[model samples]
Target: MRVSFLLFAGLLLAAVVSGCGGGSAASSEAASSGNTASGFTSSAAIAVTDPVTVGTLKGMSDALVVGDHIVVRSRSDAFVTLNGQPVYPGTRLSVLDKQGKLVSTTDYGFTLAAGYTGDWVMMLSPDGFIMVQSTSGTRLQHFDAQARLVGGVTDLYPTVAATSTTEYAAAENGGAVDGNGFWLATTFSLLPVTDKTQYVLKLCKFDFSGRQLTPPFMISTSALHPRVAAAGGAVLAGWLEGGGGMLAMWSKGAGAPTIRSINTGGSQPYPLVLTTDGKMGVLWNGKATMTSTGGVMGVMIDNYGTPLLATGRTDLTQETLSAHWDGNVRATVIDAHAYKGGIAIAGSAVGALKAGEPITDVLVLADYTLGTDPLSSSAQTILRFTLPGRAALGPTPVLRQMLFDDHAVLLIGDDNRLQAVYTTRNR
Candidate 1:
């Protein structure tokens, strides 16, 4: 299938946060699309409308859109928004149906008391596991697709944090990174391990029965900004190796990461993606060129981490959109995915976005064939949507935590309301 038809079904209808049962209609429309040379039968704009209201609590945090339902973590008394408005409290951990109805609710024993004040990290796996971590940093709780409680909080943080001051502090600051389905947490030095100085980020894999499959193993990376991805197959996990400027991958039998620098040096892998063959691909955005002209390109690496294609933008003028981060403004990567015959990337143009500043006309770009050896680039300015009345994602926005397809989904909380927005196109 072409990248155009690969909308997040959850991401496609996920934007109907304020609306009701038009989703099944929309999903049927997209799925039954005609097949064309460009791989799309029809090109249409996304249908986002009819804002309604429901819920009990003040608001919810760590929101996620799974398939056709909306799930979010909240205080002991979190509110669920049916349609568009907040109804009441204790509606935390709710599942909103396609009709914008609150179908089911779950609570992880969290209360907003004096000593307990923190957010829950709610993440969904591809195999249908709703993993949740509590307000207390060390505790972990999760449920299955049927919303049944599987177990209690597992205290592995203290054991992981024993060697260093930054391993797994009990402070409710940084939580786990939900990379696909693999749950990842950062630590300095783990037990029965060496390389004591370099920072280590490890992953925990779970079985169908919600059991930890493998012990926490150290990935080759030591930096935080350069993203990591779990592309299992021959390659288990991969991350941007900071010092060497390489796209590192650790296969199943490998003792260490197989490192191959995409740009030699002076390159930051904006976001990492896994191809259909379980290989590694990334959006190569930032560079230290003379005029700084690498404008959010598509780069694909082999399963062993070899750079096959390094595609810069052909549809854009470098000077206008390709601005580098010397100190101030910078580029932001919203999302990227592998299509039928290539890779498609999207997000902010270079130097396009700033925290708390409204973007009047935001356009997301999707390059169709960016994974070929010679870089055959057929790009599309897929969708253009704007926030209502000039709204900005404030400085502390929890956007990076959510998964995005062509349509971007957002949940904004202000004045006791959880405002949801979904942006997609009909093309």
Candidate 2:
């Protein structure tokens, strides 16, 4: 059975703030105003809108907020015969306007049969082009802003090793190449080092049309999960290896990446993000120790790869913030994005009442400024949404965290419908 439709829903909450800086008076005032219907308050200058429906889907999917559109890739559970073949579920691309209204939908002409699993990465170029690269036979697929599958590139690399890990991609200007200013920082595992124990990690550049603009630059033979980001013409990638975080800065015409390794400790680094001020920010989970609480920790570096914080890294989760939770909490960094002169993070926090008690989880939103003293401002829980408990027998719903139009939005899917809550900086 084939099902396609668009629907609208009511707004649950709308809280507006008036200033910047975490744990500031502005945040306190907004929280005290009791302007929320969902029990979530604003910490920074942000305004949250009502929930809207994007589309319906069954199985796995992905969603991203592009300039003025929300691009979604959805697949169903039912099968349909196409060209004398039963396709379990081919991937479909859907585009929705800012108002959560469906704009367009198209099939990628690619499908993954049952029990097939591989890594997939979707990136939006600065020029509104959508690029989806996967190790699941879909090497690289490109789509225009209207959600049309234009073209794709042939697979040139070997299959990823089963034991090797992968990471997200970042896109930036190509610096006057082929009338396509967009390029992506991507990684590939050419061969296994020791029978799937490790792999030779190589970073390369690919234009929007899937053209390999530069040769694959080898980074490490043991690095896993390369996270890439670009801003102000600076391309950066990082991964985990040697019990530390490996960071590298690459130029469009450089021989190799100018690399550096930082002590990420027990926590793994999240995806690399491009700050609004043309700098790169790396956020990671703070490993819980006997001396400190486990929360979110981050570092910001300039284009030259210099740490802007005096401590090299700052722990954003603490009790001093105006919008803070009680007791020690373990944070799961679900998503992070650069928006409105800073970076916003959305995730879940699991906290217990005491050392030996039950734990509850709450949706967390944190906001930080991209200023000279970025670390001086703490990461307060700007907004808190309660995550509804789920039943035991069912697939986990898809949760997407997005930062667009000065708002932080979260999309949750269940029972074939996708509902979204949009939050933005009102000022």
> Which number leads on TM-score?
2
lDDT at position 24, candidate 2: 18
TM-score of each: 0.57, 0.68
RMSD of each: 9.8, 10.5
- Candidates in order have lDDT scores of 0.42, 0.50
Candidate 1 per-residue C-alpha lDDT over 1-427 given as tens digits, one digit per residue, 9 for 90 to 100: 2222332223244333434322422211112123353433244333443223336532455555677556665545434465896434322566655444456676635332223344544556554444433323444555655455665555435533345544444332122233434444433332334454444555455443345656765554463333455554334333345543545565546666576555534444543544544565555544434334445554455657764532553331221222221112133433455444444343333222233443332323343443234232232323322334434433322221123444443344333455444434433
Candidate 1 weakest ten by summed lDDT: 319-328
lDDT of 1: 0.42
What's the distance in Å from true for residue 62, model 2?
3.0
Query: Best candidate per lDDT, number?
Result: 2
